[model samples]
Target: MADNADRAGEIIENRLEGMLGAIALPPRTFAEPICVDCDGEIPAARRQAAPWCVTCAPCQSIRERGSRR
Candidate 1:
């Protein structure tokens, strides 16, 4: 019974990890330099660090909320 529980827990953990991975957006690429929405200039450092960023922090929050629906 203990072994069975451990196996079950492992399976659950793996599935949860997979689901979280699916929801996670890939990091930004360095190719793009501007925000698609507001046309705001993305800083060079930010582009390098978070290349997948489409909007600034404030706009991103708004976009995320809309996406949830």
Candidate 2:
């Protein structure tokens, strides 16, 4: 039934939210001056805009692609 399906969906969504909340999130290190990936010096403007960037743009893109697997 549609009502049953809706309820099931809500339950699944809540469970997923709880699981995500339980996982430890990486600490915010955007205020750090160095890139964790390539050791490139992060520009002040970029750091201000994205306070949690750990890699330069190119390195970050590569890391993202790898994580998709």
Candidate 3:
């Protein structure tokens, strides 16, 4: 049988999980130097500017434009 402490812990854990799910976090893995879509090398300047970036400027621009539709 579950005790009161266990029930409280489960409630807290559930709430925490819900809160974490609502947050938008960056990927935990390292970003590759190459763009995933165009197979072009991501610029060193861009990489330095945005370490979490996964696409080059052109590919990213296209993706953004497509997303607006």
Candidate 4:
């Protein structure tokens, strides 16, 4: 019974480590003030929210959806 409990705890710890590694954030770099796709204005609010955003909101959404597939 004690061995089984230790094994379960180890499995849970491994799973937690895997999840944390998967969700770890990548290093971000600065983006330009203009939208690269449509040449639209990138709002200051958006720039503040996502400093690494290169495209505008619409383009970013499309790109994200595409990447999901």
2 or 3, greater by TM-score:
3
Better of 1 and 4 by TM-score: 4
- On a 0 to 1 TM-score scale, where does candidate 3 land against the true structure? 0.56
Candidate 1 ranges with C-alpha deviation above 4 Å: 1-29
Ranking by TM-score: 3, 4, 2, 1
Better of 1 and 2 by TM-score: 2
Over the stretch 1-69, how does candidate 1's per-residue lDDT look in tens digits?
Answer: 579889999999999999998896775558377777888877788777887776666677889899999
What does the lDDT read for residue 48 in candidate 2? 72
> lDDT per residue, candidate 4, 1-69, as tens digits?
579889999999999999998995634645678999899988888887787788999988989999999
RMSD (CA, Å), each prediction? 4.9, 5.1, 6.6, 4.2
lDDT of 2 by residue, 4-69 (tens): 889999999999999999998656555677888889887888777787776777788999999999
Better-scoring candidate (TM-score), 2 or 4: 4
Query: Model 2 — TM-score against the truth?
Result: 0.50
Best by lDDT: 3
Candidate 4 achieves a global lDDT of: 0.85
Cα shift from native, residue 1, model 4 (Å) = 29
lDDT of 1 at 64: 88
**Each prediction's TM-score against the native?**
0.46, 0.50, 0.56, 0.52
Best by TM-score: 3
lDDT of each: 0.79, 0.81, 0.90, 0.85
Off by over 4 Å in 3: 1-30
Ranked candidates (lDDT, high to low):
3, 4, 2, 1
